[model samples]
Target: MTTTVETIRKGRKFDQVLEGARQVFMADGFEGASVDDIARAANVSKATLYSYFPDKRFLFMEVATTECQRQSRDALDSIDMEAEPREVLLQTGQHFLRFITSKFGQQIFRICVAESDRFPELGQKFYSSGPAVFRAEMAAYFEQAEARGQLHIEDRILAVDQFGELCKADVWPRLMFGMTKVVTTAEIDRVVEGAVETFMARYGV
Candidate 1:
């Protein structure tokens, strides 16, 4: 595929707009953030912003998608595909926990949950970009492990759900409330160890 300069410039502008929209949404949320705010943050006129994004909802969704894709790519990139199943799972878990506890992740979760009722489509978009994507990717990894005789899981869906449940116990409470307590590296290591042990016990070679 030929890559044009105009296309590259447009891509850069889209990234800038998405980053600006993310800041606006995190600071002011859905209802509070206006097109003017996003345009000002992006150093573009309202007309230019509207030309890129039809409305605030669309802009917010785009920002959420961008964040989700970036995090997912980062997580996948950090893992060594040639590693053992257990090692890959542990590394992926640690990366996921770190990502979720970051500032941007917290803001994205807050915005999605807060505006879910008012903007049902946004909620769907958030789910599709975030958890759903993660689950699907994890399932693919599990499938590969099973093919290699590292795991005995027959059902990918069940394996994904089990992994999600394992992570949720540590992630949900902290995410749902301002429980000032931070998850330390030692604690994350413990969680990963326990989760992996249980998972392997259930489906190990």
Candidate 2:
């Protein structure tokens, strides 16, 4: 596929806006971030910024959605669909850990949790686009594994939920409150191993 200049420029501008918005939102919260501040941070004129995002709310939503989509895509891309079930689970877990620990991911999670009440639609959008999609993908993976006789999950949905719970044992709490230190590769490997072992015990070849 040929790449167009407009496409490249749009992508670059989108990333610039997202980065600026992330900083502003993290520093000032959703209510406090202003279009002026975002434009200033992005080194773009207000008119230029507005050309890309009509309003602050739209900009914030785009920033959050971009981060969420990036993380979700990373998780999906990391998994090798044709690999063994355990390998797939481990790869998924590792990528998930990386995503949650990333700077953009941390800021977006905080923004969502902090502004969820005021921006109910934002939360819904995020859920629909991110975790909901991720869960569905995972469920499909589990279903395929069961069909292939690599596993025997009675309920793919529940299995998907369990997998999330296992991964979140370390990831969620850390993201929510920074209650734990950043997860290392070793820690990710350990968590993945334990998760895989537990999952296999319940449903394996």
Candidate 3:
């Protein structure tokens, strides 16, 4: 599958190589993907690929990191910080968790999980670029909610992290293991509703 990384902004050739590498890596796990494969997919010479990315690992890191950022923006950018806490949280939770449970999301997570040990930087990159970005956005949202007297958040960062995990509590684990694949609107609503209820119980004004 073609990895969607619309948020990645780099030199044309550089992004081209990354896009190629992302497709190859997704199709053929990290260990299976080769520089030649990426070069061929990108229509650049091996030398050109290496010039942009010193090594296959670095290329993979960039693709994975960009993927994280892309997914974060895909879901988080639409959040209305000025909205009510319940509306914002519920909306964000629904979109975020739904994206996480998607095929593309599952593939990226698997890539990180599988190659993280061989390349520990992958985990750090994934976190710093993806989840951390989301957490920061959520924290800002929570801060706004607190300012509006809609939520009681003494630690906005921590509270948002909790809220993020709460959204994943019921759905995301099953996703990682391949136990569940299909996602209906009913399932998303159930998960988001539960998370919203629990979060409001603890932090509601």
Residue 81 in model 3: lDDT: 66
Q: Tens digit of lDDT per residue, candidate 2, span 1-205?
A: 5321122235457777778877897678677888889888988888778777655665676677766777788778867887889889888877776676665566566666766776666667777878888889988888888789899878888988898678767656765775775667777778778888898888997
- The TM-score, computed over Cα atoms with residue i paired to residue i, of candidate 1 is 0.75
Candidate 2 has its poorest 10 consecutive residues by lDDT at: 2-11
Clashing pairs in 2: none
Candidate 1 scores a C-alpha RMSD against the true structure in Å of: 6.5
Of candidates 3 and 2, the better by lDDT: 3
Q: How would you encode candidate 3's per-residue C-alpha lDDT over 1-205 as one tens digit per residue? A: 3222233345659878988998998788677888889999999999888767665656776877887788778776676768788888898888888777876566667766776666666667678888888888888777777788888878888888788789887578877666887777898899899999999999999
Q: Pick the candidate with the highest TM-score.
A: 3
Report the lDDT of model 2 for residue 102: 61
Better of 1 and 2 by lDDT: 2
Model 3 sits at a Cα RMSD from the real structure of 5.6
